[model samples]
Target: MVSAELLKILVCPSCKGDLEYDVNADTLTCMGKHCPECGMPVNRDGKCADKECGKISKNFVGLRYRVEDDIPIMLIYEAEKIPLAG
Candidate 1:
């Protein structure tokens, strides 16, 4: 339940990428996709969908942050790196 203003400025510390906030779910998802070298879709499971590039997506590639008590835990170490729909 972070304020819209705070959410607007928040970015992933690992990748410096955009984050999608689900208000009802109270989750923050890093909007990073694909491998820079392979150019394949990074699945919700944080793995490259391409069989050739069967690698786990980078640390910032999934739903990793959570909002608790109206505050977002933006720390990368505390981030819950779990698969979630973008």
Candidate 2:
């Protein structure tokens, strides 16, 4: 459980993208762009938009960080990858 102030200042360490906090899941997810066609996760440079989604566009992927005892584990290596594959 992170305070609103803390959550606002938190960003994805990997991509430097904004993070969305999930209260129920007690996690912080990165709001990075993805392939709008196939829904594969995209890189910060807008490359590697999944080999399937030939079209370069936008989707959403998340790097989820868990929170324990009200402390958020914001380490990039510890974050979980969540791809919105269509």
Candidate 3:
């Protein structure tokens, strides 16, 4: 588990968005807009933040990052795509 101080300071590295920590799964999820083309979080420019993606689209999805040994694996490429309910 991450320390309260650390959790308070932690944010999504990709979009600089808020993250919700899951205690049982030991993961952090960013409920920000992400590119649907490549599933990478989008930046303020409306393009996929990841260099590999870089897709310019309005469609987006949510992403989840795993935590190992209390350290969040916040890499955009490694994040799992999740559906956002309308």
Instruction: Identify the candidate with maximal lDDT.
Output: 3
Off by over 4 Å in 3: 43-59
lDDT of each: 0.68, 0.68, 0.80
What's the lDDT for candidate 1? 0.68
For residues 1-86, could you state the per-residue lDDT of candidate 3 as single tens digits? 87788889988876778999998888889888988766666777778777976798765777899987878887876889776765
**Full-model lDDT, candidate 2:** 0.68
**Model 2, position 23: C-alpha lDDT score:** 96
Q: Write the per-residue lDDT of candidate 2 for residues 1-86, one digit (tens) a residue.
A: 79998887887765667888889999888756644433345676556445655565444555778999988987755767676564
The lDDT-based order of candidates, best leading, equals 3, 2, 1
> Would you give me the overall lDDT of model 3?
0.80
Candidate 1 lDDT, 16-77, residue by residue in tens: 67888888898887856544334345667767666876788554235468888998887765
Task: Candidate 3: give its CA RMSD in angstroms.
Answer: 2.5
Q: Give candidate 2's TM-score.
A: 0.63
| Better by lDDT, candidate 3 or 1 | 3
- Give the count of colliding residue pairs in each prediction: 0, 0, 0
